[model samples]
Target: MSLAWNASTDNVGVTGYGVYRGGTLVTTVTGTSFTDTGLSAGTAYTYTVRARDAAGNQSANSNQITATTSGGGGDTTAPSVPGNLRSTGVSSSSVSLAWNASTDNVGVTGYGVYRGGTLVTTVTGTSFTDTGLSAGTAYTYTVRARDAAGNQSANSNQITATTTTGGGGGGKKVLGYFVQWGVYQRAYHVKNIDTSGSAAKLTHINYAFGNVQNGQCTIGDSNADYDRFYSAAESVDGVADTWDAGALRGNFNQLRKLKQKYPNLKVLFSFGGWTWSGGFGQAAANPAAFAESCYRLVEDPRWADVFDGIDIDWEYPNACGLTCDTSGPASFRNLMSALRARFGSGNLVTAAITADGTSGGKIDAADYGGAAQYLDWYNVMTYDYFGAWAAQGPTAPHSPLTSYTGIPQAGFHSDQAIQKLKSKGVPASKLLLGIGFYGRGWTGVTQSAPGGTATGPAPGTFEQGIEDYKVLKTRCPATGTIAGTAYAHCGNQWWSYDTPSTIGGKMGYSKDQGLGGAFFWELSGDTTNGELITAMRNGLG
Candidate 1:
């Protein structure tokens, strides 16, 4: 019998609900609903519910209700064996599986997903994601259909899959953003990541900046995303793109090849960015419609296998960013719930969130903690705390790991941001420290120390006051270290950024803090030999 009850509130918070059968506890569930099987026909069962918290406090029992099974002899025949069990996707700590359903004399109650012959979990849905698994491990899986009368079908055909090298909450995640426009003036191609040895050390890549417009997820750049042709030399593999009608090309095709070379890496389509976050308000107003549109795009058949999931990069849910949103604090959680419902457990759902740690700031402007239940993890954008945007003076590091004596603002550092989110009930394991693979600078700085006054933003290759680590590592090497980062002043050009040595220090902090992993803003900023990524991999170990 399926049972549900209204949620009970608590001062701290209700962790779960305990369902009592005949005045005795039967089972506990986090959600308000429960399903009980294996009852005799025509029998009435009395049930009551009590709410519970993490500290073991329980609420008084609710009013009792009774439910009776149908008036008939108990079902005896088992369901047919489930057919064609298969693995849909594999990650470092999870496997997505699906199978054909089985019919029974009565009705199919649920499907039992088993791993290595052990019953893992039972779900009413046709698909499930087995999580909390070890990295680089192989596990065989099978499924069995269950009927209401307690009869279980024979095991379905078994399949095996190996997990990726690094993923999940247990392993260190190294995710880097691959900007779609990097192929233009940046002169960085997807193949360069492979040739530079960055791909092997990375666990996941976020294809940045898919647009969110008209309450839908749309392609950001057609040519750079999939239309541009690549020669054999520019391809991750030695194969060149052909003019064949359906031939895949561009970054999408190259990423597919990169995955073939490194089976452990997962890729996600990330929508929204600082400049394109304006459409998020409309998305928040109608989350279900937005999620449906995103689902269709991410699961499109043309390049269905190219992505494993979607990453939302809403700059601020109910606060100000490139544009302001007034959808209220609950909007973020509602949007995430919609996405999770549409994508199901078989696909990863994550988001890139703001790191504004100030009290009553952006962090407190949304229900991020409430939304945590739906996200696989969160990419905490811990950078951009202070930068050339300040323009004239008081130049500070764009990504500070900790507070300092003369800090420009309190709670504007990476540690503060992570702690603030944790205080709001977001698990530390779900947080990824953000790193900038570039430097922010100010020109006309006289003093050698960080507090020196500056005239304006320094000139850069692409944009003023910002330069890639590849250029800064050589052009303006580190001269001092502060707040767990590096800074340099060369010929009136004052710059601050993360070096390999500083990254090692930050990684130690990541381990000490029990963080999930670290992610960088972009890939093109690193050295041609992937010096920064190498440091990140070694440091995580």
Candidate 2:
């Protein structure tokens, strides 16, 4: 049973809450909620809560609540075998599977998922996502049905899945962007990746916004990168940093700890997002020098072990972003060639390129196809095609997977971007579809559907028109789905974002296109439990 109560205040500030069961002290927690397990079946219990302070002063018990656990029964008949078991998706660290339902004399209760003949987990559904496996490895799987009586059926047909190679080569890659500024305002830390259960499902992490200035790579925030200290509670390994001379601290130290925990997971330093692409022209002017500087910085002894390679996020080479660039079509290829030559074949080299599929648009403004030869794969930024940046109405999904009727612009959708890149001679295997973890919306709208006129951008936590999935999942609640994505409208507000269901569909499309895998805009926008990334892992399996 789970119990929760309103918080109480103290003169010196409340420290923690104490939970009680039937007039007896149970356990205490720092949060407002607690879950009690190992209770008797079909038995009722009463609970109460009290607040405590640092001085050990306790407040009066609050109102009491009663709850009961579900009863369990016994039967002997076993369930029939689950039929037609098969692998649905495979990634660097996990495998997704599905099977037909089984029949039982007293009704089937659950299905047991097995890896290498060992029972891994029991689930009520027909599908399961098995994670924490090694990269570039092969494993076999099977399933069996269980009944209310605890009777299990025979194992279903066995199947095998091989995880992607190291560094996300030649297979599906589940990469997520971790922003440096997230620790300040968002309160998202490297520890959240482990607590939210995202570390085991990820193949790679892109540390965003490594600066590009004066034709050389630079740290975006030295304080956030390696100076800020973390306490024991804030550390990923539960060991605080010491203030000793030359001790590594902040996100860099935390990332090192995370890498120690997840050996197969790779980290890449990403440079030149929308706000910093202006320096690309200077870097392009001296490609060899720029590559040399980047190699030196990435290989700096202070934190050289934290990264596997480097990812270029130049918004749009030879085109427009916050500031337009006329560095010519060959600049992108030249820069990538220099990086490859300097980094050698041991380190991975990748880039995030424009998904503008429009003829003579951003895609045509650079030589992405010519540059593909020097890279392992490309993170196709397929999102942010439209949003409230247009402000006054004409609501549309920011990350539509396919073009739908009445779309604001032709060739702006994901499929169009993918086909255009392929037509430009870019290999499908080197393309990774992008999914946004947030949404874009508009307010003062009467119609709840797309194409409705709006007054302006909708209210959001940080920015007007943009919100995270954790907020939108409950705030607006998706009223409908369109163009392979989801949208919601509550009162005058209209928002569009991807739910787990929609991400599954997108992953299916990625597999159909023979693409590398899926990646998202960021990790902070996800729920506390990491719902979006979980869906991405399961969908790609």
Per-candidate Cα lDDT values, in order, are 0.85, 0.85
Q: Which ten residues in a row have the lowest lDDT in candidate 1?
A: 162-171
TM-score of candidate 1 versus the correct structure, residues matched by position: 0.69
lDDT of 2 by residue, 1-541 (tens): 7676776777656657788889877666655777665356688999999999868999998998999876756666778999988765555666557688899988987788878987666666565556557777999999989875557889999999887755333347999999989999999999999999999999999998799998899999988889999999999999999999989998989999999999999999999899888899999999999999999988899899999999999988878899888888899999999999999998989999999978688988999989999998999999888888888868999899876656898667897787667666677688999999999999988888788998899999999999999999999999877778889999999999999989987987776555888899899999999999999998877
| lDDT (10s digit) by residue, model 1, range 184-285 | 999899888898999999999999979988767999899999899999888888889998998888889999999999999999999999888888888888
Q: Residue pairs in steric clash, candidate 2?
A: 89-541, 90-541, 393-454
Looking at model 2, residue 6 earns an lDDT score of 70
Candidate 1: stretches off by over 4 Å: 1-170
Sliding window of 10 residues with minimal summed lDDT for model 2: 163-172
